[model samples]
Target: MADRSPEVAEDVDVVVVGAGILGIYQLYRAREAGFTVRLLEQGNGVGGTWYWNRYPGCRFDSESYTYGYLFSEELWRDWEWSEEFAGQPETERYLNHVTDRFDLRRHIRFGSKVVAAVWDEESAGWTLNTEDGHIVRARHFVSTTGVLSVPQFPDVPGREDFAGEAYHTGLWPKEPVDFRGKRVAVIGTGSSGVQIAPAIADEVATLTVYQRTPSWATPLNNKPISAERQAELKAEFASIKETLEASNVGFLHEAHDRKTFEDTPEEREAFYEKIWRSPGFAKMTTNYTDMMLDDEANAEFCAFLEKKIRSLVDDEETADKLIPRNHAYGGLRPPFVTGYFEMFNKPHVELVSLREEPITRVTETGVETAKGLREYDIIVWATGFDFGTGALRRMGVTGTDGLELTEKWADGPITWIGVMASGFPNLFFPGGPHGAAGNNPRYGGTQVDFVTELLVHARDHGKRRIEVPRHAEEAWMTMIENFRQYSRFEEHGQYYGGNTAGKAKAFLLNPGGKPKMMEAIGEAVSSGYQGFLS
Candidate 1:
């Protein structure tokens, strides 16, 4: 609900929503292009996900440098990441530094969330009203609302009855959460759960981790960047940027050119071991090309993972439970972990399998299940989000046909290369649904650049209305969904809007990855932007 008593409407050429990494970049592009841009963010600060998700061990799985903006050579040389993988604090600080360094903070409206956005037929623009009284009219409305902004909590009985402190990893507090000598319970075995469990295991007096499903864990193997390596990276900034843009998955690491069957039995073992030792998403991305697609190849990798977990954890059953059996190795988003399996080996830590003893409710003290009520001083909900299109669906945006965005995307999201929806005139939803499938910022930046190009085209052509024709939207959606068949993401699960209850199970990503997306954009540009109707 917006506040009553509105202020005078502020007109701008563009209004970019969500002041995350992508939002800040959009602001910079619009400003530099001579457009009066105003960025509205719900949070008090710039770091959107990093600002909220401060849970312990929350960090970048991607290479720190590759994930950061490669637009500016000066920026690449100036900022030195402490480690190969950066934690929440470092990531947040870096984003804030970038924002301040680029002078993007002034154009940002902190604490203002866009609640309602309406397309104006007569004005050929958009009227955006924030949660507060502020109003803005803009020719272009770009939403970098982001894929994982909205957190989703599972349906558990008596959730509010718990008197102890509860926190969702997606919305962690600014202040430090004390787990020392306290009985702590973590729910879900997703990426966040995998990270936080090992992090707090030593500190908590008794740590009970409730798992609904198992997650395949790989070593992050993160190390501090040496001074010499930093200098080398700085010197090779141009090549690095070129490599990232040219990459299929937007990662620095290149996949093995060979297929699974190309190598002999012993050779496969050596390669699997190499991938196991590799950090972050390298296990999946740098593995044999057929590892993601072929059942036998994926199983071979999973066997190695199972063996690794068994070796790490003392208990065989616990180790088996830690390894995913139902899904493929790279099917669901696997957690690249640090001591995740070994956390269960700790004397104070315990694992609770929901399959064996299902959780009945959350009592005042802790979670209760078929076994009994386990008392905990604090409960951490590591449950994931309604990823991709969650935030945009909640914006209450009315499109050209006087239908809300929620309704437009009710069946599923339909967009032109994940940039613009058909009925949404002059509205751009970048970095939300149907965009990136990997290395978010890298893929997200490409979409932002496309939107910026569209705006530039509009300005040059003296056209205000920018709409994705229904035919274009349909064609794009069809292509991306077809692309999903070959992707690493599990066909089901949250990848297809299955995370949120009753949401349409539609593909929300461009699984053809960066190359295919760029191809689509190139086609649109070559055809004189005919896909977009004004």
Candidate 2:
């Protein structure tokens, strides 16, 4: 439901931005804490990413059962997911159901795009200004704007010259796109590109996928859950939730403590085959913990994956091009694809290596490459996003003493625990960088719970503000740097290492697992929230 108010409210205990999954939960927690909460969403409805990204074959990398909110048992018991990995429509439906079920729509102001958030020192609160010329003031400001909310268009020349229909996978159109007998060009080989290519291959007359760097992809043996399976899962929901909480990636799966090289060739191949056949991103996590840490261990897995790729694709050249050689195994966010590589076997599909023939510009009818030009009826930009800090920075957030978030994070984002930054009082970011790397929903819930506890403490003590101390912030930064120094993620030019521009940089993920993160949060809270000033 959209807000009926002609003007934005001036008096609210808490103002939540972005009606994404995190924002909805924040609203629930804030209201439960006996505070007047208002949620501002840029979109017409809920489900931030799901609402925007309506691309074909778009689905969660995490399993369906583990990707949802774990706060309510009633929701878990009532809702039944059809697939092991839920698609965009199902995810959107689930979020909408949650919103209506919890009566959260009354407080949500839809179609309200927040342009700027400025902290007023005198008022000791935040003044949020929207694009539609409305100002909202709140005692505490929480930004649940997702990491991948902002789409990053390529800096290619003459993109506007394309006369054909152009669409980005991140911001796909709601209406169905008819690709029958039409040539489609998909630029980028990330998760979105891999998924889109396979889905539209048969529909289009020709589907050309432009790849700069190939991503490692595992098979997703996605299938519908039977009534018996659903019942068994529901029965074990409590224990499953506990297992997910304790997991490093927030997914309940078997973890091999031994090194990859420790196993014989036959034993390793058998282990790899078993995991490869299993559904979802667990294939990357379940086997050999040292895959990301040790190059030798990573190489073994990479060889196995490369062999699999070669065997799957009919063309040797295509298979070789698809296999990732530059980065170590588990370096990039490996996507769980369904018939992605196999799509190349179809006569209509073609893989364009950007390294061999780089894109020169977008012509009037098609894309012009260094080698030549290729005609297409439709163009899809799967160019990915700025990620981590882009969404918040785009909103023009200003902290104490007019400290611009962009300027502060000019080099890179520096958060205490990816939850709160120093000098940003009564402000928190759930599922931000320096937090958990994978399974955002589970990690987000943990962060929200911690932030809620902090909010309650502040309210009980009559504290006007709460912020991370400068010393603690510095220590946290140092700790993150040290962790990056040890991890091999920094060696690869992937998004996890702040390498979106194809240049290796500092690692962004918290090196410690979920349990370690939870432990740190517990220690901080038990120590009278030692790092935080209330």
Candidate 3:
């Protein structure tokens, strides 16, 4: 529907798949390097994950200051964010602004879902078959598919019998969903559920939140950026960018001092409170740098959070249920919020801890739990996503010797630097398994940027194709497994950060520290991609 030539007669030198943040950057870099590029997206518009997840209160955990492009000074200067952490709208708008400014829309084919991508060894290219029966070929393939793109719906019996509107936060409707004077039952207490429940409760007559597992959440000091602060940031913009790149996660400030957690309990408490008052993702665990490394330090932080949650929620029973006691601190993704716990004080809002009463079935009216049947006009499955391999696996992508990528990654998605597969030649993957995780929020974004840079370099250097050696990939996989074996994090049952979850085994995050992970990438780069042959 967008202004583009028919796919029947279109082809390009390279195909940059998925129009998420990384995909957009890949297109810009490829085009700038004078390589013919075609961008394909399944959605009608740009902003991949943001485009689909339009649920109420959807937001970014990372602050707006360093969430976006660092490659262009002019682009960063032109767009000023309203808050430290930009909401979905601001993030979406910024992407749109970038798209418009760079004219990325021209090369992107909207409403085209790539169903299959089979490698053509003779031509050293990929033949992409779209769901609409359109086929296109490209010499190079770059998958910028997001890590958490695939929605994971739990197996609830009789779900098909539900008469009411059932929606997943990952697949929210494009149009506004009105919950006025209706009973709304929201499942899952992860980031999405925590965010949307509070905002939607204000409108709905009664809101019920079903929680499977409690999460560690702290206050998100979300506020409007003052003009004075904006001006100050503008004055020191160059230094900010430089700081972002040099750091492990590409954040503006250095990661919490590795020695901070070594202090006394009183000293640790004081330090954490100071950092908790600051803006951005570092507030929760970064203050005490050893929070992730040492169990004793982790317990102290968890106790601190338990106290905070207890103080916030008025109901003692609900507060205790809300407080996480089972998992170790920093095991799962830390939930951040503006006023999440405060919403529990509202009479209309209720928390149903599913551990006590597991969901049995979904009837025509609502869900039936072991405790009782709760009727609702609408049900929101805020039940997170399939991380790491799901995004690429769902698309049915294939590699050399007619090997299906999904089959190869059946055990778990493995890669040397989380960039390329052993069998997949000339295909680069950003945000794959064994790359960035936990302590490295900005690593995935920065790595994607770096991958784009390396791609540009390879193109400019006249390399027709490249592939990682099987031995190198095997070595990297062994290193990752060993890292997980030594770390005590597995006891916490956290996925990817090194837990033995069968389904989450393929998640793309290095359990080791970000500094070490980035160092590995730097070493790979210095070797002129030694393990990879062109």
- The most accurate candidate by TM-score is 1
| Model 2 clashing residue pairs (backbone) | none
Q: Which is better, 1 or 3, measured by lDDT?
A: 1
Candidate 1 C-alpha lDDT tens digits along 1-534: 122346857789999999888998888888988999988889888888989999999999999998998878898899999999999999999999999999888888888878899998999999888887789899889999898899989899989899989999999999999998999999988888989999999898999999987878789999999999999999999899999888878888877899888999899999888988888888878899888889898888888888888999998888767777678887778888898887888888899999889989998888999888899899999989998888998888998769888887878887877878878889987787878878889888988888898899989987878887788777788888687778666645678877678888888888777777888888888988885746
Pairwise lDDT winner, candidates 2 and 3: 2
Regions of candidate 1 where Cα sits further than 4 Å from its true position: 1-6, 531-533
Note the residue pairs that clash in candidate 1: none
TM-score of 3: 0.93
* lDDT digits (tens) for residues 366-427 of candidate 2: 99998899999999999887777778888888999999987877777888778888878888
RMSD of each: 1.9, 1.8, 2.6
Q: Judged by lDDT against the true structure, how good is candidate 3?
A: 0.77
Error of 1 at 83 (Å): 0.5
Model 2 misplaced stretches (Cα beyond 4 Å): 1-7, 490-505
TM-score of candidate 1 versus the correct structure, residues matched by position: 0.97
What order do you get sorting by lDDT, best first? 1, 2, 3
